[model samples]
Target: MKHTGFRIAVIGAGAIGQTFAESLLQGSIGEIAFMDLREKPDFLSDERYGRLTSIHELVAWRPNVVVECAGHNAVTTIVPSVLREGFDVVLSSVGALANPKIRTALCSSAVAGGSQLVPIAGAVGGIDALSAAARSGLTEVMYTGRKPPRAWSGTAAAQEVNLDTLTSQKVIFAGTAQEAALKYPANANVAAAIAIHGLGFEKTRVTLIADPAIRLNCHEIYAKSRSGELRVNMSNEPSPGNPRTSWLAALSLQQTVLNKVLGAQWAA
Candidate 1:
């Protein structure tokens, strides 16, 4: 519905951040302030929106939630501090939690400040079903991520295979979700999201493929639990601004924010 005074602080002014901001503005859900190291984008020049320099500045702006879309480094360094300030964090870089220490720290910080770390289901579906099945005890969870060869550039996948000459799908990595997320931080966020919701990092199996035949990023997930078996497949177009990420990722974060804000409104 109408969130009159709600505010959101977004970390990172990149593609995802901009998209989320635009979506909020279009829906008139909340005001937005961006905390980023880079120069402010033209769209954020409006005086109503804030361009913050640090976490302290962002906290001072008094946002109901802080959304992290910068990357793994921001998740490690910025998110915990924001959470410790008692602001709920909508995390886009779920892959960063692959590091046990970072995950633990974020959890401790959230507990310390009485805030919550909300990880959105980015570039994938079936998270709600998987998370529900987890309570009933899941036996197995597997995720396969396939994307265009250019999408795998600059990541560990590029080093593992010749992305330029690949004519067919090549399995670049096959391991636990933790290993895959750690090695391919930019590409395996869906795997991490699956692990977090289903069988956790160690138990969730992950396979990453670089395919020359595909123009879209594809995600396939399979899980088995006492409740039943589940299979999901999604084909996502890469963001026009950044091929490394799916266009749906930004929209997912936007939906997460809306759900949080609306849920709060309903409870109130």
Candidate 2:
């Protein structure tokens, strides 16, 4: 398809959000704009870009796509409004999709407007293969996420166990992807993506860990289908600004924006 540069509005200025916006501008793909609750970040340095301020302002100057780099609250509030106005969206916060009613509403909005809301593969890989495996009737899929004990400091992990004393791997949380996403929203983006893609949320299993030994965030997935089995693992370096988010997550957002703007997309 021939391309007219897309008007992109990012919805957060945190590490992942800024990284995605910076990467997009660096590649010279689209006109970079941002929408956040906070003031314009000095990083982008473009007056045309800044905080969106309110939903009214966002609808007033509608962009082709709005990347919801913010959290689930943004998804529940801003994203629906944007979608209802016929704007497609790239949702980096996959955990928000765990709310079945919210997911249905968002899907309806996209369909009503003839647009799309896509989930980015944040930290994990093997999603394409895992999803393909699903079509063949997969049996088992599990996602284990591990981050440093200090990394889990602010989270409920501290309450579950003594994160400071953990010397080896410890599974602090075990449940369905839905529960995982709800309890570990900031940390379960990749796991939620894997669950939604492989088997519906209820069928996918999740394990959360606080590892004292590993400095970087880690993600691993194992799946067995009628076709066969696949195992994928990655130890991710956190985004410079947000230690909780994987660097690859921001890159995925930027790359998707590039495909939308420049019409150059990588094959899976």
RMSD for all candidates, in order, please.
1.5, 3.1
Give model 2's TM-score versus the native structure. 0.91
Question: For candidate 1, lDDT tens digit of each residue in 133-251?
Answer: 99889999999998999998998877778889998889989999999999989888899999999889999999888888889999999999999999999999998788989999999
Error of 1 at 66 (Å): 0.6
Please identify model 1 stretches exceeding 4 Å from their true place.
Answer: 39-43, 46-48
CA RMSD (A), model 1? 1.5
On TM-score, the candidate that comes out on top is 1
What TM-score goes with each of the models? Answer: 0.95, 0.91
Give the Cα lDDT of each candidate: 0.91, 0.82
What is candidate 2's lDDT per residue for 1-268, written digit by digit as tens? 3234457878877788877877766665556667777665676576645556777777676676788888998898888878888888999999999999889989988988778898888888898999899999989999999888777776777788887777788888999999999888888888789988998789999998888788898899999999999999998887888777778888888777666664433321
> For candidate 1, what is the total of clashing residue pairs?
0
